[model samples]
Target: MTASPSAARGLAARLADGPVICAEGYLFELERRGYLQAGAFVPEVVLEHPERVTALHEEFVHAGSDVVEAFTYYTHREKLRVIGAVDLLEPLNREALALASRVAADTGTLLAGNICNTNVYDPADPASADRARAMFTEQVGWAAEAGVDYVIGETFGFLGEALVALEVVREAGLPAVITMNLHEAPRTREGTELPEAMRRLADAGASVVGLNCGRGPATMLPLLAELVDAVPVPVAALPVPYRTDAAHPHFQALVDEAYPGLPSGRPFPTALDPFTCNRYEIADFARAATDAGAHYLGLCCGAAPHHVRAMAEALGRTPPASRYSEDMSRHVYFGSDPTLARLNLEYGRTL
Candidate 1:
């Protein structure tokens, strides 16, 4: 199941050929597996249960992810400090990167180290920016030592924080894939338009820039189209696999009318099962994103192996997992096989 060393290519080089899928949202996915908590969302699972992390990476690779991104989304120093496990910061990040590296090597997929929004970044506070910079520097340094193909800076809602990440990644001399998270408004939290913000990242040497998380295909696509026109570099679009419409542009804003009185009053993080997109919708998103000039495509939170497989197939790739793709022809009632009972097939209409 491993690709030869000769077949390995860098992220940008692979992007030149066609779409590159980087499966993200590890925090949410692992939380569902019960290894990690949802509230803190820290990836202590990287150290607590290394095997589970490795298994998830391999699953994503087999399902057709072109990149095995480290599960260090919220493993930064600030998040660790909040959970009173600041000492576990370096060890957790290194472990996550090591786990992802092994899977990427085995599957011949690109290896990526990750950095995400530091909840501390505030444009009005220069000290907060300093703390964010230090966090990015340390994480990017570890990723470089781990010899990742690139560093992915995602889910950033503030342009200032994203710029800090880009600078740190650049300082480490690694290709940077910087993406922002739009919360309801098309503009960043700092009041910058998405296209202009992406342009700034691209101009500042980001290899790829676009949007990730906080929106679904319906809401993310329009913003993606704008970025493609603004930035000359290949755009990245990884949306949450949810049915977010204009009324509910962000998953957090989605009102679960069925459960009018939920504790948190929101379906995000958990209890979003009712709003999840089916495999067909993900496939449609893949096709549309490709046509809209987004060479880097994937699902953010709520992504599963089947969704990844569907995306790869929609991009005209038959990944290893595609072998088990749905075969309606073999079904008992809707099957086209002649050997099936005609009576059962006829009675399927009533059922």
Candidate 2:
């Protein structure tokens, strides 16, 4: 199915129909594919390897993503300057948005322009706010010109910064999905409570407001429960697909005493293999998130195509990817069919 530019439904219209599955975690997924850098986290691949970006977007859409978000997570000017690639800033943003637009049109998915934490906001220094706003405005302008269905401002650690992002999206006259990222404190960096922070974003005209990144499903759900009751706007919850607990509420804070010889003294970016959640855990999270009143559901950071498929299935929808979903009953040793080899079936227990 194809949705022409005039035929595409907006983000709000889609949410009214049913749950919206947005596939994020492009940074981690592309890094794993050897097309991106982790520490820098810049999506230069959008310009360097357009096919790689296009393929990933197609994979996510086939896996049942309702939205095809542009890979502009860290494509802001600040991140580009950090790596001395500021020259590629505008080109990268335009390319990413163009790539996402094609996929969304082809797959009949909502296309979202993305702006994330600027890493430049500081309450003490008022100049920081201007810098952050400028970055958001430029990126959002490109998105508006590209004709995205909406804009998403995510992974903010401060209500103040998130408000700035919301302001930019509203200025563009596009629907806004604002999501915060909580640290171990369960509060914004400026010390406002999570629920209150979401209230502020919603009041500022965010179409959907809630939490993303930082915490895992276990840690993020309790927070989402608060937002659902406190904020009137639709709530969004996209947790990192990791087993984060109260003791280690955020994946970055997760430790592995089993491997003490680590390079960063933590298991965050590259070393979180042991902490990754399986498909079942992701399915469980999807069910729990809906129960908690979060209508905008997705996986962050460590998400994979299988995890997205599991989320879609948990929501009672089978995407194109479901055609390949596991059927262990058909295995040589696990099959119960009369045609199965009895010798291999009996050998399964002893072996």
Candidate 3:
């Protein structure tokens, strides 16, 4: 009466293959909700309004998210050092994972540890790569210890950084997903082609790979199609809010007038008036992603719970009920700084 191993794996694959709705980054979503003022990163705001982190996760779960990413995207030790919270990295990472886990357990969803870019892009310097690798390994280890089911490396602009992150997640023995932010040309920031990036990430040991946090879906469809043809693993698309060329100046002035203490010095772009995309547009994006070989569909910035619901309805399936464990190690690799040869060896044995 027991299911075969292949059958079980098949079921797990199906569940993991479906759409994975996203809640926007903690700081961005909270700012939109008016829970936190603009111009601050999640870690800084977490120190003052920690509960907002938990609330954001809960909201996404209620909105039918199959997976809820931990709010630790910017909690890396190096970034924390810049913010004078170097000592708080461990606590914040652990707390963020624990909070996401707790909410996932309660809502029957999965938790993905959010591993973001190092926020330091210096192509001329090899040291930046070393530092980025170190930070990624440390954060992935912490996520493993804190019990995250998968490490979701989101918003990476460069393929090299994504490779480093994939290596770290592989070494930690965890499922890993990589989302690249697309430029106007549909290439990564480093100028690597999307198809090439897909091949490299799959070879580097990523379970899921796709595009997220770029220009709106309208601009991302062709890129998604290219990615679909390049990788055998499940793909995903998470587009952010559109940029309004006409109103950007006005919005920047309004944000400056409203929040003079903004840290990044970049003027706030006008918030999409929530009507940027209607249900039909949202459904069309989801349908295109699904048709283009993106098994996982969701929204990034400017996407709300209504979008999630609409996408789910478009797919004609409810969110999966199984919860994801941080320790599963379904398709992971481990080591401090493993070379590609070593990664290939590790991957071969796992297969």
Of candidates 2 and 1, the better by TM-score: 2
Query: How accurate locally is residue 72 in candidate 3, as Cα lDDT from 0 to 100?
Result: 82
Best by TM-score: 2
The global Cα lDDT (0 to 1) of model 2 is 0.90
lDDT of 3 at 22: 58
Number of clashes in model 1? 0
lDDT of 2 by residue, 1-351 (tens): 222352356777788898899999999999999999989889899998999999999999899899899999999998999999999988899899989989888888888899999999998999999999999999999999988888999999988999999999998999999998888898999999888888888889999998889899889988778889998889999999999999999999999999998898899889999999999999999999999899999988989999999999999998999999998777788766667798978876575
| Pairs of residues clashing in candidate 3 | 148-326, 149-325, 149-326, 170-333, 171-333, 171-334
User: How does each model score on lDDT?
Assistant: 0.89, 0.90, 0.68
| lDDT score at residue 231, model 3, on the 0-100 scale | 92
Report the C-alpha lDDT of model 1 over 184-302, residue by residue, as the tens digit.
79999989987889889999999999999989989988777778989999999999999999999999988888997777778876889999999999999999998888999998998
Over 4 Å off, model 1: 1-8
How well does candidate 3 score on lDDT at residue 52? 78
Clashes of each: 0, 0, 6
Best by lDDT: 2
Candidate 3 lDDT over 147-213, as tens digits, reads 6677889888888888888998989988888888765465777788889988899888888898877
Compared with the true structure, model 2 gives a TM-score of: 0.97
